[model samples]
Target: MVAPLSAWPWEHLGIFKYILYGPLAAKAWYSWMYEDNILKDLWCIHILLICTLRGLIHQLWSSYNNMFFLTRNRWIKQQGVDFKQIDDEWDWDNFIILQAMLASMASLIFPSLNTLPLWNLKGFIASLLLHVTISEPLYYWAHRFFHKPYLFNHYHSLHHSSPVPHPFTAGHATPLEHLVLCTVIGIPITGSILMGYGSTAMIYGHVLVFDFFRCLGHSNAEVVPHEVFNKLPLLRYFIYTPTYHSLHHTEMETNFCLFMPLFDALGSTLNTKSLELHKKITSNSGKNGRVPDFVFLAHVVDIMSAMHTPFALRSFASTPFCMRMFLLPFWPLTFIIMLVMWGWSKTFLFSFYNLRGRLHQTWVVPRFGFQYFLPFATKGINKHIEEAILRADRLGVKVISLAALNKNEALNGGGTLFVNKHPELKVRVVHGNTLTAAVILNEFSKDVKEVFLTGATSKLGRATALYLCRKRVRVLMLTSSTERFQKILKETPVDCQNYLVQVTKYQAAQNCKTWIVGKWITPWEQSWAPSGTHFHQFVVPPILPIRRDCTYGDLAAMRLPPDVEGLGSCEYTMERGVVHACHAGGVVHQLEGWSHHEVGAIDVDRIDLVWEAALKHGLKPVSSVNN
Candidate 1:
């Protein structure tokens, strides 16, 4: 059980907790319809409006800061926000929700706020003074107070749990802490109103600015320019930088001021290295770009997937991709993006992380999956992939893995074209299929005698058939072409040739319990398998689960090593901290420090070798995604 001090009263409600505010929203809507002057209902409405606006501000800052591409070099914490931190700060806006209730109650108790003028210049000026003299010092002292043992253990530690603070982390606090924060924040607005001059504009402006600064400070990236601080050296004393507050989290003993560094200086608690480190970080921003040890070359699946990128909408990207009612409105925008990027696009960095000590980043090809099918788009896609390879080679990237459609044999011969075109290229271009085949073939235990196969002539399928034949495990290769079957059969040893049986139709495997689907199979096609058949796939856009009795495995993926840091976004539909096997394959290549390019045909001999390397480096098979 959670301690009373750490748990909120509504913690058990989960996402359903929003139902608490449903009545208030309905009341506001009802009042708007009936009331002639809606200003009378502004208090009720403002609560919802401020909550929505504040959430958006926090989200925008988070999206920018957490998108590894934008803040790669400037990250305050050189680590990915893990599942632990994400869950801890999941409901970061609970403070605002509680404040909505408190503010509504305060309005009922005091009627003067409802009748205030549209704009009060005196109140605006007073709000500034009140925040400077009152909110700042009070928050500073209260923040300092929480750092002491007892309160720190219970309340403040919740906020501090996220060492690398995202903007949402600004509000990830215990109820007691938020209550104190609400008081500190409310002081200026309440003070200005009681001074008999507070107005509508003053209330909105002060609160929004407070939220803006808070979000900006915890952005986890140095967005404030060093040039600005250099120009006005004294401005550093008045306004705090993200780096300044970051030290407070890392160092934990100094820079206690809320929005200003003035109190930290007066309190004699400013970190000595704060300004120097801030300058070093901000001055070097974009001077020389980050070079990764490994690069995962990826592409968007469709227009909908374009909106699901890390930088697009962070909260959305954090979860598994699926259709949401909220995303319906953004379809037109993403469609426009697909059109605009189709012709004039180049590969760009998407996300990054550090594993052990190696830097790994994902770079995206601008082409969507459908476009790769278009004859016109194949050349353009290959061009982008080539440009990315050249960039990686120039940056001394040790290994670059081609993912999904980006490495399709038809488009660029599984990246062999690029490797051949640039023969002197130092970077090892990997299609990662050797490990992919290992992951698929390993799915069948030693007890399994035979298995059904689809798309048997494809590279991964061919490699699987050859590997299994060596083990004397019969492979019912599904292919109509005698030439392709004989070619693959010849590759296997003379003794194992009988184990590779060529079948032209799905009905050949009616008694087979293991169905290794390497091609798209519809409901009618899937019906050929017996009830207990498990589908192990290497197919893109994994086939749908149609039969209730038969189970479906996730796409080939590996849980990244526990030591892997800063992997924030889920790769496609894989879970957090889990990556596609191909991605893990490239990481293994780099870890093993292999010099050769892993492209074109799958290397059947190295299947077990790569799997062992992956296992050695702590990458575990995530064959069952339910795990």
Candidate 2:
């Protein structure tokens, strides 16, 4: 059965139009009463005031609707919307203001344009028709020209920066491009005036209508009901909708019509995606699926960090030159190596249905054998992580978390090489190490005056050791090198060194009441720990086996509120009985809907915030660790 077609609410339309045009109409009426010849002074202060008011009102309306209305409306789903893109739109508002000022100056310079009479019904109809006929084809061609490679990169690309468009976005173009657009739009009105078939009222009315429809086209919210098109199918060819213009922004090569769909149909440039989306948005079937609030990319170390293996050696057989030179001989070996690695590494979707009723997904890219200890191998591993990140991005992941060794490789700049190399991905990358450090420190008891710390030279280890020293806790720093330990002491505060004891031997750490393992050490080295000491393991792919005597803890996990639907079982060993601080940090940001890099040297305050969020989510310490 066909649904009954309904007419668009006249009152709603009237209210919307009047909000924009009321101020312009009042100014025009006041000017008409004072001036005997309105068109004689085209640069009149009243007209300039009206243009400024129109621009200001248009901006205000767009902001209010996009922020308050369109974002919440299910029909205008916010899945593809990028906040960075919205920020760019706000930046473009300055260009729009400049365009308005230039428009007023153009009026002052051109006295010949002031030829239109104040009131003439025949002139009004002729001017309106001429504008529709002339501007449509000109705008279509000008838009297509701007899409050419050079122009697009320089000018028109700003307009197409966002996948989702809002009303104010209509004016979000480069100044030169805006001028070109204005000139094209003015052609028909100027022609009508030269032919003596234009009126001042008609010119102003046409501009009001043009601005109104342009805003509507970029609103991203469909205001026109589908039933109207269903009832009168021919009207679809006559008018262009917001969905139609969105395709031009998305697909970037089609639908170049200004205010009419006639040119688009005739030129065969109409996009079918727009029509399909319009139908889907207006029907019941489109409303069922859920859109993820946040997405993340995570990379885990494939091989143990101690191995210090070069990635080129690990992937030597797969290199292009090796494959070409050896052909069949290398092919079989490469296949075997790839099969083994594929079994070792994997990408898993970590879906979180949290306490606040938010659904988020994190793409965990576990690197099986990409680990390397040398500086040169860091780039190879980064490249491997980059490929995984790009793959996640293709699946619509919005952010990425560099976990464990991934964070170590990306420290200082937070995967900047990947970001700089792949600007097209637009995914936010963060090192989850900050919160991981916080969770580890939180495990230390207040009564413990002395602590044994390993991996003292590592970034996280250094940061944690410094923090512990600052709190007046006696720290016995254990590392493999005496030179590195001396360097660390020299970098530490004068008073901090007094409380810190540097040692190259595991036996020196035996007297310490608390043990924190920050680096990978052999299980045989674990024999030096005192019988009753608390053991905290921070290293991923944990080095020490779980013991019966000591309280062993890793990172904390974000506990799901039992009632949420579609909850998945915990996967990571660190998250099996307890969550890792790094994993918890990613989950916290995902639940709160923030995208940022948390890499490099982490501060104590950020750690506190993440730990607090973990506590709020019901995360608790897992007493047992995997061997």
Candidate 3:
């Protein structure tokens, strides 16, 4: 049996966790719907609003801190928050629920708490005074109490687990520790009520201010301007910076004050370097960050996929991509955000990791997948892609890879448009299709003598066909254009020419058990495939599993080497630490220190060479998906 102090009972609630707050929400709704005195019963509504605002504040901080390009140099902690930290802080909102429940019960026990004036100057003064004199000192000593060897081992260690804190990390604590915190928060609040000075505005203001400070302290980004302390030197003891709070987590024994360093000073436990480090970090904030050696230029697929961004929802991005009902409520908000980004945003650094001591970052073009099909959006999309390329080149990036539709041949001629426009550019522009082809071709077993191919005329298609023909495997090239098909057939040696045959319709592939799809196939088109056929796809927004009897493969992807470091988010629809082959291709280029631009048509001869280079550098192909 688990010890009583080891875990919280409600910790296993998972998605049903929201049910705890349903009573308060339902009360607010019922009062608005049926009660004549809705205003009199609004204390519950106020509580709900405050809870929502607290959640909003935490989310905003999480989003802003993850925008590394803006806060890279200003972050207090240099290390990134990995998947473990993300998981640990996932339930940070638990404290909010407990606090709400306690406040509701208090209102019932004390009739005066049910209805109150909106504002009172005396109440505000009372709250401020009680917070400074009672809450602060009580919290300081209570915090130190939990730090005792026995208490910390069983309780306080949970909060300390996230050494590189995010906004949510502020509320990550054991239930026992939170009870002490509830007391610490409730003392000031309850004291004001006893003195008849409690008012709605005072309550809201106190909690909002409390939440603001807590989120700021754990945001990891150094946002407090150093000039404030410089202008008022004595104020250093009154306020705590993110850097100050960070020291508490790292050093453990010092900087125990809550929001103010005054208590820490009184206790003689303040970190000595807090002020100095805050000043140094703030002084040079936004001036510089580590330059990436490689960049993977990608774009959003759709509104749903947009929320899967690392900065959008940390919990969502930490796992494999799947549409969940929870994301439905966010659609309207995400739609508005999409409109804003369409006109305002540019290529942005999404996430980064290190491999063999070299830095690699994923930069998004801010355009959605559907928008790529819009004729009018073509120029704008290309403009963003070009800007990212030039920016990488200016930053001395060694290799910039284009992912998915970002390298559409018609829009930028497989990245040749940028390469030719900037002839003097030193950064290598890579479409990475060579490795994409190799990944697809290698999926087949040697016994498979023939395979049906769709999108037979596309860049990846042509390379796959020629490579397979070279292996003497008969390839049923599906296409309407005899001219394009003959051109690819001509590229193969005369003896192997017969292996590459042109067929105009999907019906031709009915007999083939191995189908390589380079183009999207509708359910009707997919019906042509015989049962038990395995579909290997390089298609974007991979085809649906319309035929249940047939196995389907996810888009071609490769797993990062075991030694890869600091990877915290998944690539779109790809599993964590696994990326599209094009992405891995550029990684290999950077590791090999190659100088040529991998643009336009792929070199069939280089497919094997690139594949070998990727394995040599420890990048392994993700095992084929069968579903």
lDDT of 2 by residue, 57-130 (tens): 56654544433212334335434333244445544444334444555565667665565467768766776677
TM-score of each: 0.95, 0.44, 0.95
Positional deviation of 370 in candidate 2, in angstroms? Answer: 6.3
Ranking by lDDT: 3, 1, 2
Q: What is the C-alpha lDDT of each candidate?
A: 0.86, 0.60, 0.87
State the number of backbone clashes in model 1. 2
Decide which is better by lDDT, 1 or 3. Answer: 3
Arranged by TM-score with the best first, the candidates are 3, 1, 2
Write one digit per residue (lDDT tens) for candidate 3, span 148-196: 9988888889899986878999889887778888887777778887898
Query: Considering lDDT, which of the candidate structures 1 and 2 is the better prediction for this target?
Result: 1
Best-fitting candidate, measured by lDDT? 3
Error of 3 at 541 (Å): 2.1
- Give the clashing residue pairs of candidate 2, or none: 297-400, 302-367, 302-368, 430-597, 555-579, 556-579, 557-579
Clash pairs, candidate 3, are: none
